[model samples]
Structure formats: structure tokens, C-alpha cells
Target: MSLSFDVFWSFRSPYSYLVTKRLVRLVEEWDVTAVIRPVRPLAVRTPDHFVRMDPLWRPYLFLDTKRTADYLGLPFARPRPDPIIQDPQTNVIAAEQPYIQNLTHLGIAACRMGRGLAYIDHVGSMLWDGTVVGWDQGDHLARAAAAAGLDHDRLQAMVDDDRDGCEAELQANEAALRAAGHWGVPTFVFEGEPFFGQDHLDVLLWRLRRHGTARRSSGEAVDG
Candidate 1:
């Protein structure tokens, strides 16, 4: 038997970025498989949520994320273009529309191709690392996808066109995530247990190891 975990990820999430780096290492070290399930960020699916964010939330996020970045020694900066790509004057988010659609769809596509982890790391880094000013541009996303060894052109074309096949798959992922009892990014689920946030990864790992040992000792096949 092989151990497997499902990761509920969101590209618009800075916390997801932090989790990705650690998750990559965990899967390799533990010899386990990670099932990446990408979903649209809360801002897109529920704009009202964004509007309700407290003013202090932004500063709090910066402080917390900085501490996490320092601890992990990973590059950290506020996203340049920000996930909410909109015109200040008109309050229009044309530039952002494609990203919400594409990021969500790309996860499903990568899963289909068995390259879900790669896709998440590459694209998620670009969105969270704050290296680029505007990630909404097709070129930026394409380049990131290329870095992940995926066919940039094909992925871009699919995302740009909102191909029904991909969109439908993403919707399913979102539904599954919601049914899993979490609406946040970087949620890890094992045996129906939900752990939300990067801060909980260690706890999750402990659970996995404990469960693995118990199963093995009970004469059950050990998962990797």
C-alpha cells in the first residue's frame, strides 16, 4: 500500500505558497503521493468575503507571512500584481477573470496528466513570490508553466479559452473541497480529517506517521 494525501490549494493564497515548499519535501522524504486539488480563491468565488475583511487583516497577514517565510528561509514578498487584478477607477477586473478561471482549471488539468504537484509548485510560486508585478498576463503564467516542464502553449490556450472540459473538472474539485469541510487554501485532508493552514502541516505529518505505524503493526500493508 502507498500513502497518499490530498492538498487543497489556491494560487491566490500566500499561505499556499509557503505550504508548497514544505509539501514538496514531505512527499519526497516520506515516499508518499500528494493529490493536488486546486480551487478558486475566496475573493473570486465570494467577493463579499473580500469586502468584509477587516482593515487590520492585511497588516496581520503581512506580519504572519513574514515570520513564516523567515522560519522557512523561502523568498517572500507581497504579490506584485496581486491576485485581484482590477482597474482602480472602474473597479473592473477583466485582467483577473482569466486567472481565477485558469488557475482553478490548471489544477484539474495537471491532475489529469499526473503532473499536479509540478504545476502547483511552479505556478503557485510565481503568484506568491511577488517577483512579477502582474501575473495575470498570459506570458507570466505560460513562463511559469514552462518552468514546471509543462507545455506552456497548450496550457495557456486551454486556460485562455475556458475550455469546458477543464472548467468542469475544476468545479468538481471545488465541490469536493467544500464537501471536505474546509473553504480555505492549503487544507490537507487524510482519512476525512481536515487540517487547515500551513501551520498545521507538522501535526498532519505526525498523524500520518502514527496512522502508518498502527496499520503496519496491525499486519496491514504499509503505505510508502
Candidate 2:
């Protein structure tokens, strides 16, 4: 049997967006499966995740995330309208959020259809690539969904009707992530070990290699 890892991901995390560029490669180039477990970003989950964060943290994150995107040659833009509605001055989050809930639910539905990883790569690019003015609007998500081989209509239908189950799944994911010894998105948990951050993908690859995790056949295309 092949090895699999749990990806604790959040749509609101730039790191989650940044990491998937290589993550897509990881799955394609190696022998492994990534199970996507979408979690509510802390802004939506606790409302204070960013508010209570260090004063210098948010600014540095913005600077770092954009530059990192450039470093990786990935397209990126600050989310227009932002995922969670918040007061920039006070970091006070609002209660009536429309975007994140819909996105997270569809993400869960994608996982159910076994296309979660692809959906994230495609859809996350739309959300973070700064190419689309409103990533959630019009044909943006639809195109992303199609690129990932998901039926957005059906996914939304499932999300609309299965609120309780989706929340339960997200809650379970959060609990499992905490149990794995981290409370961060973009965490890859393999064989009960938690590898956190975009920087950890290489280390995770090292561990996978050392442990005899499967490799692609010769000349199979690392980026394929």
C-alpha cells in the first residue's frame, strides 16, 4: 500500500497558498496520497487569531508572503475584500462572512470526491494569484473547479444541504491538527509526524525518502 498524509489547510492562509505550489509536485512526482482536511481559518474560527497576534506579525506576513510568491515565481495578490471581514485598524473581525464558509464547504466536498488537492492548487491560485478581482465571483471558482475535475454545482449542493456534517468534519480536522502538535495550516502529517510550514516540505521529502516512501519511475516528469 502507498503512504498518505493529512493536509491541514485553511483558505485564508497565504502559507497554505504558497506551499501548494510544491505540494502539487510532491504528489505528482512521488508515490503518495494527500488527504485534504479543510479547516476554518482562525479569523473565522476564533476571530482573534490575527487580532491577538503580535503587532508586527501581520505586516511582516504581508511583506513575506508577497515576496515569497515572487521568489517562487508564483502569481500572487492580496485578497481583494479579504477572506474575513475585519477592521484593519483594530483587527476586529465581523460576524457576517460570506466567502470563507462557502469556500471551505466546497473544499470539503472536493475532498469527498477525491479531488481536494487539485482543487486547492487551482482554486487557491485564483484566490491568491491576484489575477481575479473577486476570486469568489462569476466564473472564477467555476473554472478552477473544472480545472480540478470537480462539479461545482454538485459540490455546492452538497455543501448547502450538509452543513452539520461539514462543520463536524471541519471540527474534527481542527481537533486532529491540534493533536498532531501544531495549530498551523499547511501542516503535512505523515505517519503521525507533523511537518509544519512551506519550508518543511523538503524535510518531509527527506523523511519520506529515508523511510523508503515510493518514488516515480525514471524520467516520469517531476513536475508532471
Candidate 3:
């Protein structure tokens, strides 16, 4: 049996985007399963999250994310409209947020179709790679879905067909994240051990190896 781990991720997190590529690589190379568990971003989970942050947090986040993206050779840019809508002056989260809600549901739908990691990686690149201005407009998500071998219309239809079910799954994922002892994105939980942050990916890999996770043998086909 393949070892399995849960990847707790949020669409609004730049660090989540930063770690996805390597997570994809890890699945391809290891004898393990990555269960992508999409959760509402902190802004949604805790309406007062940003409001309570230190004044310097936002500035440092921008500076650090850009440099980290550059270091990783990944294209970087602020999401054009931002995923979570909030008042810039007051950090008050908007009551109506369509972007993240749609993305979260779509993520759950893709996971149900067994392409969660691929879906996030392709779609995330579109949103954060500075490639498109209005990523939510037109057929952008559809094209990204195609890249991940998913039918875009079908994916959306799944979410539309069972919005409540998807929301329930998301809530369960959030509960699982907390149960795993962390509430952060890009957290890789192996055997219930929570490894938070992209910077700790190497440590996670080391731990995986120590627990006997092995490289895929040549000629063994890897699948999502």
C-alpha cells in the first residue's frame, strides 16, 4: 500500500502556491499519495485574521514572497484582483466573496475526480504566475482545467450540482487541518505530523524517507 499524506492548502496563500510545484514533484517521485485538502483561507476562516496581524506583516509578506518566488525561479505577482476581497484601509473582509468560494468548491470537485494536485498546480500558476490579468474571466480556468486533463464545464457542473456537499468537504478539511495540529496552508501532514510552510518541505521529505517512503521504481507508471 502506498503511504498517504494530506496537503492542507488555501487559494489565497502565496506560500501555498510556492509549495505546490514541489508537492507535484514529490507525488511523481515517491511511493505515496497526496490528498489535496482545500480549505478556506484565513481571511474567511477568521474574519479578523488580517485585522489582528502586526502592521508590518503585510509588507514583510510581500517582500518575502517575491524574493522566495525569485529564489525558486517561479514567476511571481500579486493576484490581479486578489482572491479574498477586503477593504484595504481597514482590513475588513468583504461579506460577498465570489472568487475564493468558487475556487474552493472547484478544488474539491477536482479532488473528487482524482486530479486535485494537478488542478491546483495549473490553476494556481495561472492566477499567481502573472500571466493573466483577469484570470477569472473568459475561458482562463477552462484552459487551465484542460491542461490538467479535466473537463472545465464538467468540473464546474459538479460543484454546481452539489454545492453543499463541496462546502461540507471543505469544512471537514479545515477540521482535519486543526486536528492535525496546525491551521496553515501548504501544511503537509504525514502520519499526523504537521509540516508547515514551504521552507520545511525538505524536512518533510527527510521525514518521509526516514519512515520508509521510497522512490518509484523505473518503469512504474505514476498517476494522480
Query: Candidates' lDDT values, in order?
Result: 0.75, 0.84, 0.90
**Superposed Cα deviation of residue 171, candidate 2 (Å):** 0.8
Worst 10 residues of 1 by lDDT: 215-224
lDDT of 2 at 42: 75
Candidate 2 lDDT by residue in tens digits, 106-133: 8998988878988888888888888888
Residue pairs in collision within model 3? none
Q: Estimate, for each residue in 87-183, the C-alpha lDDT of model 1 and write its tens digit.
A: 5443344535765676677767766667788888888888777687777765887788787778877765666676787777777877878888988
Assess every candidate by TM-score. 0.83, 0.93, 0.96
Residue 200 accuracy (lDDT) in model 3: 91
Question: Residue 104's C-alpha lDDT in candidate 2?
Answer: 88
Runs with alpha carbons beyond 4 Å of true place in candidate 3? 219-224
Relative to the true structure, candidate 1 has a C-alpha RMSD (angstroms) of: 4.7
Candidate 2, residue 179: CA error in Å? 0.8
Q: Using alpha carbons, what is the TM-score of model 1?
A: 0.83
Estimate the TM-score for candidate 3: 0.96
Candidate 2, residue 162: how far the Cα is off, in Å = 1.0
> Which candidate gets the maximum lDDT versus the true structure?
3
**Which residue segments of model 2 deviate by more than 4 Å?**
218-224
Report the CA-based lDDT of candidate 2 relative to the real structure.
0.84
Highest TM-score, which number? 3
